[model samples]
Target: MYIEFFVNVTSKAWALPILSSLHAGIPGRQATLLTATGASRTSFAQSMEHLIELGLLERNPGHGHPLRPEFRLTEFGKESAAIAHKINSVSQGEDQDLLRRAWTLPVLASLHTPGHFNDIRRSLLTITDRALSQSLKSMESRNWVHRSVNVDARPPRPIYSAINTGGRICQITAPEISFMQR
Candidate 1:
């Protein structure tokens, strides 16, 4: 359920950064959000429209000019923003890049405990094997995940575990799950 929420929220290229900016208390004006998130003018506008369409944000009809509107989070947006903030706080470089992709967070969360490929696949039921493999490879390259071989097993098997950085990402994101339960 939360994986679906994460994918929906991150569907737009600028969505995550915009949410992070809003959660950081940046003003909701178009110019402010664009500047704060460093999103291109076109991308910012499109993301704003997409967010409103998703019912995560709403314009304060009388607050600003139509061409430079102001927006505020709906109740749902607030919860989503909180999650974005938590994810953003723990990420850097490639990790941040990975978080913007759908299924990345779920994959990382599954690795909070060491797991083999099939173990993670079962945990994130909706992910494709190709997508999981790609995400894991990307994460390993970034050093967020460590892949080791278990040669002692019948046929050598690969094991994956979240390294310190990845574990911290999971730890930080844990609160977002608690928020959802509330």
Candidate 2:
């Protein structure tokens, strides 16, 4: 249930940053959030709309000009925002970019224990084969994940494990996320 919340909140690239910024006391105005997040206007707007749709955000009834409305976190959104804020606090500069991607954290959560490609896929459930492959490869290049061949297995499978910053993030999120285990 909590993993679903994380995955849903992260489906949009700018979503977590927007939520984290809100939680950090950055006023929930669109222009301010866009500037703070450094996201393009279009993507930022889309993400904002997505958050609203997900019931994480709402238009503040009496704030700002109509054309420049302010938003606020809903009860559920506040919970999610705290998690996002904690995760963001651990990363800085360039790492922020990677953390905002759709599958990164959820994938890292799946990698908390070393597993094969299929194991990760099964855990994420909604991730496609291509997306999982690409995410694993991307994390591997960053040394966030280490891949080793399991020669003892009949087919010499590749096992994936979160390491370094990725491992830290996995641990940070482990308490909230009870991901499906093989």
Candidate 3:
């Protein structure tokens, strides 16, 4: 679902490449491929840090040096990635077009309030402003949501609301039944 919402390609390029590199083994000398793909080195590095912090990956100890640690996927990490890939494949269905606009839980929760993007973002932490803006535009284009811009103050803000609630979970695009179907 995240893939559909964040179709920037850059994000995919950043994530998939690293995942593919680690597909066969862990603690591989994979930095070269990360550099060769023209992926944002900084973003890729940051993601590694974030993924590690998430406890999905871990560095081995003893033989491993502190600065140059060997990494491996935790059981939870591998299972989660596997489940994500499988679910993502299922969500695309045969047409696959709808798959590009995946929705996240926070985005759905934001729509629940109907007119509080700020509150939604605060509730959803770590979502970048650029990503939120891009997602709002995408959601509006799809007619899945409605937006009202408020510019009475120094910095303008927009509030988003869902148009339909049937089968909706947090966001309209992410229907509640979709999980059961999976």
Candidate 4:
């Protein structure tokens, strides 16, 4: 669950700090903690690859070296981490007052309506419009939800619906379970 949470925020860019420490000489150090609090080598590599593809991270800037390029966060990568922190603070109940307000958000009760973007936005304690958009897109891509796009205007408006059709919005994906096995 924690890994999934970070995946949403860091989007693989979460591995930047670990990769940057390649030369630090800690051969078997745990880079990030999973929701279960277990750390493994495979998950770390996979996370690195995911972030690399997203362009949130890249090989170290130095051109010539025998060592693999160190990983570093792009500007966007930092922003992503910041946004994740804000969302997690509220969602994880780190802030009592914020969480209370978020619970009152209409989308929490009526997520079936495509027109509830504003409500969802308001419920999040500190997430930006961009993060909300990304979360919706990620949820839609994972088949947890469906997006209804309104193409009748200059900027498209998207409404979301549960893909499960039974109101299920969350599920453990195969990779998530696989990580646990490691």
Candidate 5:
């Protein structure tokens, strides 16, 4: 599912930045990703290995020294990178600032359909209640998510939904979900 893909890509702090750098015209080499993303050597190596393991990146068999492989985005990686590009483009101002934080995209994606706090938390799997609450509040402030109270219930329940702008982000990132599902 897209949530799984979202988690996979975001699990590493440097993953998005590496993908963004590559998509932004940086060469697909360790040195380039490292320089562009400003990731420490260890983090860069780990992130590159993770991306390669996830099938998002493939090393060029004939290029570079064996110890320093030149990488390129696979078809799946290209699709994922494109979606990342769109996500970056769709966000602005506070929304853009929020997207820089971990779990922001996944939270927005989870709210594609209206969900209660528990539902969104369940979708994210690894997110803590506090983190989810903070993310949702930040998104609410940015107008990316709308929260409403279900007073009709015995106990009022809060429901969260993606606004049109949030929906646009989810739509743009849909390919990542499909790509990972494959």
Candidate 6:
């Protein structure tokens, strides 16, 4: 459920940033969050609506004009926001762009213990082979993931593991993500 939570929450490009900023104590008014997240108006609105739909956020009923309403985190939102804040804190510079991708964090979360292609695909039921392959290759080029061949395997399979910043994030998140039974 925890891993799935990330999968849902990260569906929007600005979700993590918005959650992170709110968790960091930035005011939840639209203008403040918009400026802090540096998200464009349309994407930011979409992300905010998505969060609200997910029950992670809700408008503060008594605050601000309707056109520029304030928002607040629900209890679930707070929990998820804490995780988002942790992820946001560790990501730096170029990594920021990669982390914003829909599949990246969920994929990294599954890499906590290192897995083969099939293992990862099984863990994330919704990911396509090509998407997983592309995400792994991209992270590999960034040095966030380490890929090694298992020569002992009959077909010589490639194993993937999170390293460095990716490893740290995995350590932080994977323990909390409940893996679904096969």
* Root-mean-square deviation per candidate: 2.4, 2.7, 9.2, 14.7, 2.8, 2.3
- Evaluation by TM-score, superior candidate among 3 and 6: 6
Between candidates 2 and 5, which one is better according to lDDT?
2
lDDT string, candidate 3, 64-94, tens digits = 5665556666775675444334334332233
Compute the lDDT of residue 14 as modeled in candidate 1: 82
Worst 10 residues of 2 by lDDT: 173-182
- Cα deviation of 141 in candidate 5 (Å)? 3.7
By TM-score, the better pick of 1 and 4 is 1
Per residue, candidate 4 scores C-alpha lDDT tens digits across 1-182 of: 32333333233332433432322323222332332223255756676677667655565566324343355556655544343333333232232222122221122223544455776675454566776676566545545457777788558876666554213322312223343223
Residue pairs in candidate 3 whose N, alpha carbon or C atoms collide under 3 angstroms: 4-100, 4-101, 4-102, 5-102, 108-170, 108-171
- Which candidate gets the maximum TM-score versus the true structure? 6
Candidate 1 Cα misplacement greater than 4 A, ranges = 93-95
Ranking by lDDT: 6, 2, 5, 1, 3, 4
- Candidate 6 has its poorest 10 consecutive residues by lDDT at 173-182
Give the residue spans of candidate 5 off by over 4 A. 38-40, 65-68, 92-97, 174-179
lDDT of 3: 0.49
Q: Could you say which candidate leads in lDDT? A: 6
Model 2, residue 159: displacement in angstroms? 1.2
lDDT digits (tens) for residues 27-97 of candidate 1? 89988898887779987888888889888899987899877778999998988887777778788755566
Local error of candidate 4 at residue 23 (angstroms): 20
TM-scores for the candidates:
0.84, 0.92, 0.42, 0.33, 0.80, 0.95
Model 1 scores what on Cα lDDT? 0.80
Per-residue CA lDDT of model 6 for 1-182, tens digit only, reads 56677788888999999999999999999889989988899999999999999998998988989888999999888988988899999989668888888899989988879899999999888999999999999999989999999999998999999999889889879656643211
**Cα lDDT over the full model 6:** 0.89
Runs of candidate 3 exceeding 4 Å displacement: 1-28, 32-38, 60-70, 87-134, 139-182
Tens-digit per-residue lDDT, 1-182, candidate 5: 78878778877767777777778888888887888767799978888888899998999889988888899899888878877777776766445556657787888878767899999998888999999999888888878889999999879999998886777887776545656677
TM-score of 6: 0.95
